[model samples]
Target: MSAPIQLRPDETFLLNVGPQHPATHGVLRVKMQMDGEYIVKAETVLGYVHRMHEKMGENRTYAQYLPNLSRLDYLGALGYTHGHVLAIERAAGIEVPERAEYIRAITVELNRVASHLFWFGAFVMDLGGFSPLMYAIQDREHILDMLEAVTGARLTYCYYRFGGLYNDVDDDFIEAAKRFIPRMRKSLKKYDALVSGNIIFQKRLEGIAPVSAEMCRKYGATGPVARGSGINFDVRKNEPYSVYPEFDFDVPVYHECDSLARYKVRMDEMEQSLRIIEQGLEKLPDGPIMVEKKPKTIKLPVGDYYQAVETARGSFGIRIVSDGDKNAYRLKLRSPTYSNMHLFDEACEGMLIMDALAFMGSLDLVIPEIDR
Candidate 1:
């Protein structure tokens, strides 16, 4: 327990939701002022698990920082890694191979599905629905196995090198991915019947803590948080990178702006990700997975270079300032979780404490991503 806040007779009292609360999704604590069951104000208190990822980037060699990106958002590690690699590749003017880009797209989409599956399960578990978590995790395990086969790690993968991926996708990996997609589609239908159609779940989320398009714009929220509010923007579509431009997919958006809208956005995005992966598999050309004649030590031009990628949670960006050295002179990370989370102060006002938590779940926060 934290030190109790002083309260007046009629004034709202403070409730510390957690630095360890399971519903928080990660090591996050929210200091909320409550009048009965209604929240008057809410503030997020971070820095519990800070590892100084930006500083680590500046201190370590460019290649050495690859693993640090994964630690920022373990659930969506590959996306962060992709962003970092893209930044380095752009700054160094290194060309990634066509096959490599396709491979990166396939693996990253698989990772996205895995991350969303975990979120779906954990988010439902936060609302006292336990069975969906089991179902979601069971489906997610296949994703982990598939990623582990290629990346050599189940979580927090650093599978991409600066110019390309660390390895190529083998026939076994491709065959396994082909089998996983249809099964995942079947699982989504079951999830709709189990959680989406549940009266209690619907009542808990519908119209609760509605976020407006203006509010998302004010806070720089992106991904499902912004899409949930009818903002038709996606980094993959709006700002195409890698081989995403070659693929055909839809960016799902909902106009409702409520917790349900946010929930549906993610639910729809998982299907779109599957489509991207399937196309990537079909269009995967025969070529080297890595570029040859690349510099052993990365030395970017003396300027700032930035790259952004659509991760499972939202847009993850890497900005690097280089002085033509092997290590970064200055490094910054623009994490979507930080932007999406800032809206809570405004969105949660006057909401029930439980509804506020549901709203937080809809944002799909990964705390390390925010803290980094």
Candidate 2:
């Protein structure tokens, strides 16, 4: 996904695009060698947050390490936590009740929508459009209010347990969630009308940064970054984890392969998430959320266990190696932003600095996960 950087030693000078730049969304610094206004080469500098989540996973017991997963990509915390819990559940041979899996799907999809909503505002703001932030945050508060009522925490929710949820949702939560579907649908229409067709917005994004399917595959990109380039892959559909198989929804793909395509993919994904939540509500079974015969302690059989789940940014994977002990021998995380950020060097070459920032926005990066 990269090319040989043809540096113009005499004409070019270095410029830092981050560390404090609003466009980065975090403390990610991009070192760029610029030839006048065009970038000659770019290098992404990470390690701002020294959060050693992997090492922490090895130090803590399987059950005790739950909270750490929620911090990696705080915006899509549930999906990352979902992968960790799913891996542990698989390793321990625990069976989650049918109702719990449905709840997981519903709550994670709500998290996904919230993630996209924030990204919508922030991404637009990154490109110098300010009003969208107000509107997007306004709509996102409704989702946050609902999530807080059930999960008891909003942003980095550690709600999913090894084989079930922290607790069963109340009737009030269910009714509020049901009402949210239509309200969110109306909100989405308002967003489209307000932002999608705006000439300035379209001009700023469409055809700005084009990614090819070959390039995405080369860099191992997933989620909207790959789907924007027409790669038909989604962990919920392709891998079929948890209750995702029971639900019906389409993986939104756009062949345009530009910034606009990535934007459309996330926007459409919110609606699809709504569809999933609606289906989950309708088919929500009556049963205990946790297994009846639950063990007091969890010990993974000596082996390697892994699980992958689709998050807002992309697929977040967790791998645990255990030696028949309480603590994991080793833990590894496969984060999508790392791979997605890999495309920046090649994607930004020869483009104007502002356009390069626009391209980076399209990637929907969550940098803390990259640091992990």
RMSD (CA, Å), each prediction: 3.6, 2.3
Candidate 2 lDDT, 239-357, residue by residue in tens: 88899988889999999999999999999999999999999999999999998877677888999888888989887788889999889999999999999999999988888888898
Error of 2 at 155 (Å): 1.0
Candidate 2 differs from the real structure by a C-alpha RMSD in angstroms, to one decimal, of 2.3
lDDT of 1 by residue, 1-372 (tens): 122434443878999998999889889999998977778789999999888989999999999998999999989888989999988888888999999989999999999999999999989988899999999999989999999999999998989998888888899999999999899999999999999999999988888888999999999999999999999999999999999999999999999999999999999999999999999888999999889986798888799888999999888888888898889999999999999999999988777888888889989999988998
For candidate 1, the per-residue lDDT at 362 reads: 88
Model 2 stretches with alpha carbons more than 4 Å out? 1-8
TM value for model 1: 0.97
Candidate 2 has an lDDT of 0.90
Clash pairs detected, candidate 1: none
Using all chains and alpha carbons, the TM-scores for the candidates as numbered come to: 0.97, 0.97
* Model 2 CA lDDT for position 180: 89
